[model samples]
Target chain A: MSTAPATTREILIATIADLLDGVRTVAVGASSPIPAAGAMLLRARNEQRGRERVRVIVLGSREHNFFTNGSFELFDATAQGRVDAFFLGGGQIDGQANINLVGTGDYPTSTVRWPGSFGSAYMYYLIPLVILFREEHSPRVLVDKVDFVSAPGSSEGIHRTGGPHALLTSLALFDFDKEKKRFRLRSVHRGHTAEDVRAATGFDYDAPANVPSTPEPDAETMALLRGRVTGELSECYPQFVETLVADRAA
Target chain B: MGEIVSIEALAAQIKDGMTVALGADNSGPAMAATAVLLAQRPKNLHIVCVPISGIQADMLIGAGCVGTLETSAVTLGEAGGAPRFADGIRSGAFKMMDATCPAVLAGLVAGQKGVPFMPIRGVIGSDVLKMRPDWKVIDNPFAPDDPIVVVPAIRPDVALFHAREADRFGNVRIGRQAELAAMAYAAKTTLVTVERIVETSLLADERSAAGVLPALYVGAIAEAKQGAWPIGLAGEYTTDTAEVARYAKMARSADGFAAYIKGFAQRFEAVA
Candidate 1:
């Protein structure tokens, strides 16, 4: 919206905010600064518009989280259909939207181990809108098939009301087709083309004849993101805010 | 009633090859007790990180004290991936029981209720379900053709954690971190390291009583001021991010990890 271009981080934040539209209650897991920022932006905007305020729960935070019973309450609420949206990431993601939060290679003994799966297996099925967010878009990350399925994108005849809604990376945005169990390229972020996404991605996905560039945040949205959202996010993620400040200085 | 004991005594109670349950990062981990346990160097310790953990778990793994680790994840938060944990997994230093956060909690809940297993939704097709042969999948009794996964109860031999305070009566104040209570209830013995031990009953106050873990569950209590150091206790001190970053960097290799542990032991020794 402003003459100054949005940084890749800013673009990603706006994209997540857009994806979070109509989400009433969104919960973010540990160490997720960008998703937390996006949820904060949405909550701030909704409050400004005099609409019903969105409830953003960033876990491991005393200020933001409303849960008193720890993650037990969170899991219970999600099972009861209280939480509307959530975010998940993978060490490896395939075309089928299967996420591998575990390490590469065989089970029990992995070649390259990552942090074990948090609540992705349960949250992905319970939360109506689960966004697959991994900033890295390289072939190693977005693989043809994951070495391990930390949480499958779709289940056969499983009692699942929720699954992958979209996959957002640094290069592009892809919407997951639940029926077909595949990802469709929705839009490419600015400074990146569909070809760039294809080259980086390891698996195949559907793309339109003319893939549109992701829409940038408006002046108002950008203002809120830089001002109030950044201020709120600083409490939980000080280092990430410092980077944003550094980006501004640049 | 739980008796007041020294950290060393508490560590001595945790014998080798016992399944020890630890509190999560925000749930007041007993790092001082962990240090004593590291010094003791117990072998074949099966640690159950109640959902997730950080440097404390990694340190134990790096020190070669743990034989098996059951955790959802082990990370240093903003500091980055836990290098020692990754190294252990790569080298097969200990058996890793990969679990999701909810599953770990569910297993504890099952243990607390003295149930054989607890049924949970949404792990049907995941490899976490595939790997855990102990977790069973069966058709839902209420609904035909609907399937669910039932996780076996995880009753630990010992539950170790830190709390803000423990009264003379051994009722520890755990605040909003109720998962600590689950650990206490599910474990055979509960060892607590508290910042202070007060003469006045924590249960005497109406507000404080809501967050108190009763003496019936506590096996022993140890007074260790600023016990959850470096990681820091919530509302008391902030996590030393720089120190954790240093650990993350230095724990990348066996020698570096040894050096870090040696320095850590020296620091603790000097303090003692």
Candidate 2:
């Protein structure tokens, strides 16, 4: 019998979980369910593996966030280098890892306006590990160049301690090379090929001779993702849960 | 004890072209103030949203009350993007600062400290920096080899926020959201509207004193029941889903905005 294919969310979560390994602390911003789920799952795995319990701070969640000081508290934590990992997305991401949380085209007068960038630039500098996650892997998202840079992937001239560690797209995962200032295709997600990524991506990147397929989530991981993870995710992202998990079962 | 003003008196305090700062996001927005402001339609006003602005920004921008929106994000979260805000920016209805979230926080910090500017590590090479020339880059004073970015302080004329309750003495209790104090520090005057005014001792009690905003910071207090309605007041109630959706849909166009305001926002005062 053919097993139902894992979701794009699942693949993304697995990739994030892998990235989150050994990371002792992560702070999830508001309205990010996938990253929150991935952090929750990572915490579970740390417990299962008998490792040091990672401190996960899900902003705006009472159950997860212990700090009562709000975003200021989170920013303080980031500034202090206490937060080990974070996630950021953009309307457009270029080869050099420039992210445009701001809209496409000009500033103040944008051709297409996105919900303005919030805290990305600051967090990118403070957090030791920042993972770039954009579920949509298309030319529109992975572009030749962003119309406006919300946050530059590589701050060549700037005083900064943190930047993108890896970029996870639906089609593939790319590890950002800080020294070279470019992304290299680490692996392509299953059911997607390197050619597919090449065709969809607008930026040029160095490709390996043979790109490996991204690993699938194991039974234990899937079990947690479907059961406990889904339950916790529902509290924050009820609608998303209905579609990604509940609807699948139906 | 501070002055306990009416919504009308509060509305009177804001003038055209004033820089206003309101609570960020759905949690602690001063919707009653926003509603009154929408009715007044004072032009050329600038709003400083600490981070996400959501429906409050959308409504103000849609109604054309705001001249400049200096914010990081203005989306409605799971409810989807702020339609009017997106349209206003794409169509060039008003000016935008296009600040990142932490940058705004940093600016607030600078404003609170009464500093000329504060140095921050990020946005040194980002398009956010490129777009905002008003923000400056300076060589790290201690480290000549390193360069840093400094955001100018944002000092708003007014800071308006809604809280769960306030004492008769005008001490506001905002549990779990101590960041509200930063806005109070950044603004010349901080105005608050609360669900009700309890006895001074009620708020002064040990259990609630930690959440109390001393009367010293509050210039005016108004007892407006459900002051943050339509928008959610954290720990009190969730957002009115239908009302928010209705506003989002109706504020998509000029005619829709007028209709929406007349029906919901301004309607409150029109009846009064």
Candidate 3:
């Protein structure tokens, strides 16, 4: 590990890169800077190692996205099983991994409303690796059950090649088991413990007797993240990069 | 035949309670035409966002011009959550038909192809599917036990958008925003606002022809410089982020939203 302490955001990015191993193409949605950074980190690391280049498509970016036919091309490619990995965030996620991007209450007439589902309903089923990401880790977001399933974690008798592969939050990382339709706590981030994760999480999950802290990025990895990845991310997420720099200073 | 009309005249073609489709953020949204529509005070307008939308949808709902909205999502991107859209949905100001991006695009594709419905995978177990009784789950007849969700065709009465340029012959240059072409093809009538009108036909140039939406699909064209103001046209101008951020802040409350709209109307009226 580097002598300089790694920021929580950097650790999360490193964790995301770890999860994205072996992925050929990864698509990050709009307003998702961290995931986009993680994808870029993987691409940068691959370039360093002379490995196969990972195609990272960041939506809403003129430089990152190559889809000429607009969003239709992205959806078509996903339908044809071209997109390998995707990121989905929800207002609420349950023990079963069902996500709620819609709102808190019932159907059309809801007490509170988030942005409606973008493409999760389709992409979650087709993309082979779907990573659930939410920075805020608490019972409010990690609920017992989602009020509305924007996209189910698992479907019965449905042809689904993709579902929630793993969930990464500010506190910890959990891997989803498709057969059990449940999440198992993998590792807690630095400065957080298994007890903290259990206390904050609303849903029950299987946690091993001894959990390990998420590995910190080595000197080389941290150097790549600060240099090349940040530069590429500035095109779409200038403000986010500024904040990341500010966090490092703080 | 397509005719050159004023923005006000183009807005007049959109009657009360008509299903109107608008292009997404990157696909040149007719913000200037939208201003005229808001000024005219059309009612019960069913606004269909090609797949996703931004400030235009927020403004329409804020001004009470829309009775129903069907789209994948309504957001202001970096500006934050669309305050008006969230308020409207909370208060039941209008009916919201929640949909996924692909589903909405698939619906438009079905409408363009003159098909009753299009078979799409996923959304089987989603609450979005549960709310939409119109969407059906059927077994794929060709593949024995394969079940897929089919979305109904979303054929709008009129499609409205802004573009880089168009010819007097009504052919509009949409660039690489193919979803705009999808909306134009699916709608019964297509109205366009352009930055300028070219004397030469768009179809005449082979290089430019691929990106041109033919005059056959376009019902009328109105030349409005900076038609997609506040938003932007690719290679033309960038999004007015400061103005959008200001709108987002002002629109947090009902009174603030009205005041913002009032100022917007006045600003555009002064320009006209």
Candidate 4:
């Protein structure tokens, strides 16, 4: 590997890959391209380490996915605890980790409507580990309170095997405190500070003094991400690969 | 016991104001029936989708054939978000009953068994529980003091879907799309469009027997080749991504949607 710079995108992807250390299987959703890339990176690393088989299921890729019933199989597998980690995003997310995939104004009749929660509510409860990924980090998306709760981070009545493990944004990553029901700032990205995160987010969180910057993808990790991971991701996310890989090369 | 009829004749059975259930993503929409429904423009019709719906729902909403939609999500896939559905929902054009995928499937399964309701594990603390007033939370009779969410059985008047192939005796071979079987079983009448009509014994043969839907469930079958055009038929063809993108853009407005759908609906008649 040369001394080429690591993209913030790649760094974030590698971080997510590192999160999948103990996860046996990771299911990436239809709309998630970055998470898909990260899952592939994890698999690549696993193979490089000569570890046990790790299943990475990215929806719409024939080579990666072998389900007959599409999302139905994903839901079933999650319910049975087969899926160890999953990904979710939202139009708006709150301090409590409530995701609002519905939209801006209100229920049934939101002013700005996002796609209705497909199976976020169902999967959030079943999968033991969930990583909330949203690139757009601002007050608009990361809010004090979500307009609608598509899936709640903490719950009582429903039997949930898992909930939000952490929230990864462009600026920083926050660990969800299941006990406190609040986010604890884990680390800020290299280019940004805790104050920058505070200025943008509409919610409050506990931040340690002298917060450490998120580590960039090390030499070998970047190689795995750029080389094997990019190739594997091309089958499903051609546009993404072209934009990130080809354009970067050019 | 009519084993085969024209697609138009089959679509006619879906009267106005009737709630129709469409198949899941892999099984694909019954494009032949969908075309006729668009042409017929039956008012106040309600359609239920298991989870994610493709452009078929957008086309229906655009054509003013649907008064209500019950599904988890509706988008045009790589094409984009369903424009017509988005616009319609914003303008209070119809009713929407948002549900998660499994809840809808569980409802369909309950309907198939003619049961009052089926109990499920999740949805107890989410907004879905609050939005859906009908779905109840009860203490499990088997294990008292434990709360369980029960979904109401959603039996539709008719179930419309497309399959890979069917036998002359009306048995359908849907292969891996087992959810289609659940949809057909839940509806009062199962209307299907297939690519070809095989010998009645083809369904009984050991090789093909496993995927066949019994004749008792299917009320009508039609041979509409490439019936799931633009969308797709499982294991047959991929979705026409370009056409879907065009639909997504065109469906944003009334005139644009009308113009786009005109060609799609007309194309079905020439083949039929």
The numbered model that scores best in TM-score is: 1
Clashing pairs in 1: none
Residue lDDT tens for model 4, B1-272: 42699888899888899999987555768887788788888888888996668777878888888888998888776676778878877887898888878889889889999999988767777887788888899998887567888999999999888888888777888776778888888989899889888875555689768777888888899888878887766578877667677777888789998888788867765644
Q: Which sequence of candidate numbers ranks them by lDDT, best first?
A: 3, 1, 4, 2
Better of 2 and 4 by TM-score: 2
- Candidate 2 vs candidate 3: which has greater TM-score? 3
DockQ each = 0.84, 0.71, 0.80, 0.59
Clash pairs of candidate 2? A118-B101, A119-B101, A119-B102
lDDT of 2 by residue, A105-204 (tens): 6667777778877888788877889999888999999998888877778766566778899999878999998888889999998888999999999999
Per-residue lDDT of candidate 3, residues B161-249 (tens digit): 99999998888998889999889899999999999998999899887799999989989999988788788678888788888899999
lDDT of 3 by residue, A1-250 (tens): 2346789999999999989989999999999999999999999998998988899999878899988897698889998989999999998999999999899886787777888889999999998999999999999999998999899999888888888999999999999999889999999999999999999999999999999999999877899998899899999899899998878878
For candidate 3, list the clashing residue pairs, or say none. none
Q: Per-prediction interface RMSD? A: 0.9, 1.6, 0.9, 1.8
TM-score per candidate, chains pooled: 0.98, 0.94, 0.97, 0.93
Off by over 4 Å in 1: A1-3, B266-272
Cα RMSD (angstroms) for every candidate in the order listed: 1.5, 2.4, 1.7, 2.3
Error of 4 at B91 (Å): 2.1
